[model samples]
Target: MIRTLYIDEMNTLHVCDSPYDIEVTPKWLWVDMSEPTKEENLLLSQFFHFHPLSIEDATTVKQRPKYKEYDDYLFFVFHAIDLRTMKPEEIDIFINSTLIVTYHKEASEEVDKVWHTMLNKKPNEKVTTNEVMYKTLDAIVDNYFPFVYDLEDKVFSFEDRHSVDISTENLIDETFDLREDLLLIRRTVLPMRDLVYRLLEGKVLALSKKQKIFLHHINDHLIKQVEMIESSREMTADIRDNYISLNSFRMNNIMKILTIYSVIFMPLTLIAGIYGMNFDVMPELHWKYGYLAVWIVMIAITVGMIGYFRIKKWF
Candidate 1:
């Protein structure tokens, strides 16, 4: 669907269903296309005369976070993340001195919020394309905090031995999954950081002094996000290594016990083997007290070895 927000010279706000509904030249105009149909997509080329490449990029989803300078307007591609799935939703923006256009394949809470704020502005309160862009970008970046904070909390929980009650295998699996989520968030954040930094450089977009400050604030947020993600990823690695080491330690203890038992049985097995041999080794078998004597010797050997192992604390 296509929607338009137009502000007049008197600082009046007008919301329209289509661009054609705006009869007068707007001081500031914003057009939003959400899940646009093929016919609505053509508005970019036929009505607004956007470059075909820019149009294609806007229509397409999953474009990396970036911006391109055009002769008349600056084009930007940004990602709005789904916190639950850690998936990115693309929001494409076209902005000039007076007009801003936003396109997305799905509904955008960020866009909707700024859109409503613009609509509800008090009388004589002027809204500019720059303000709208900043607000939208701010909202997008702000949404990232909850997910990152949640990831950090989970990592902390993993580090606390008393907090995590699951098996080592399951804990490791969860840590790996958290790492993957951080990677996903990183992919979205790093490009966004670069995009905001470039915007701050002002080589393309001619930002005013105040605008630069606001954009710089957003850049700061992106930097904070990047740091948090990196720290969380490292924590996940530590958690995984700790669990693996614990598993190895447990396995070594088990193998030690099995080896001690094997050593204790080795001599007994040898004596039994000799006595079970045929005629040539059968002198003890014919002795009147031979069975009892052999039993005594075997018991003594077993007891003595056990005592030696206990003294050495081998168990």
Candidate 2:
């Protein structure tokens, strides 16, 4: 769907379905496109005379996070997490001195929010398209920090209270999940830092002094988040290695104990097997004391083997 927000020279705000509804050209106009149809996109080209390449890129809908400065306007692609499913959502923006256009395949709550906030300003207060772009960018950038910090918190918590039973399989599974989330975040945030930096060093719009300062701070925050994500990935790898080593040690100890028991029973099993032979003339079987003697021999052998193992410090 296509929607419009037009603020005229008298500092009045008009939300309209079409630009033709307004009698006078707006001083500041923002056209928002959501889940745009092919026909809707073609209308954009006719209305704005945007670079064909830019329009194609918008419709293709597989843009990476980037900022491209065109002859007449600046184009940017941003990624935000969808609140409902926690997946990446894209917002493409085009900004000129007096007009701003935003396109996305899905409805963005963030974009709607910035629009309302700006509309709430006093009616007599003048607004510019650059101001809208700055506000919208700020809103989208700010939206990221909460989710990043939450992920950071979860990672720290995982580090702090290490699970008691750190089985290798379970630890590996959990670490992989966390790593995947961080990777998603890193892909979006890192490019955003670069985009902000390029905007700061602009051939695009001449940012107001205030906007310049704001962009610098956003860039700083983004860089910090990238570092945090990198650290979290490293921590996951460490946890995985620790779990693997511990599990291997546990398995070795179990095997050692079983081997010791088997060794200790070897002679006893031989003695029992010899007496069980079905020879009618087995002399030792005929003696009543022979069973008692066999018990004493087996007990002595078991104790001796255990003592020898202890002296060698093999347990």
Top-TM-score candidate index: 1
lDDT, model 1, position 245 = 93
lDDT computed for candidate 1: 0.89
Instruction: Provide TM-scores for the models.
Output: 0.91, 0.83
What is the per-residue lDDT of model 1 for residues 141-243, given as tens digits with 9 covering 90 to 100?
9999999999899888875762657588788888888899899899999999998987787577667789888998999999999999999998888778888
TM-score of 2: 0.83
Q: What lDDT is reached at residue 211 by model 1?
A: 85
Segments of candidate 2 deviating more than 4 angstroms: 9-11, 159-172, 201-204, 266-301
Q: What residue runs in model 1 are displaced by over 4 Å at the alpha carbon?
A: 9-11, 159-166
Question: Model 2 over residues 1-315: C-alpha lDDT tens digits?
Answer: 888888887778889876556689788888889888888887668888899888877888588888787898988888877776667788888888788999999998888998788768887787877777767777777887787787778667766556664455866788788888888878888877788888888666677788788778778777887888788878877877877788889999999999999999999999999998999998889898999999999999999999999999989
- In candidate 2, which residue pairs clash? none
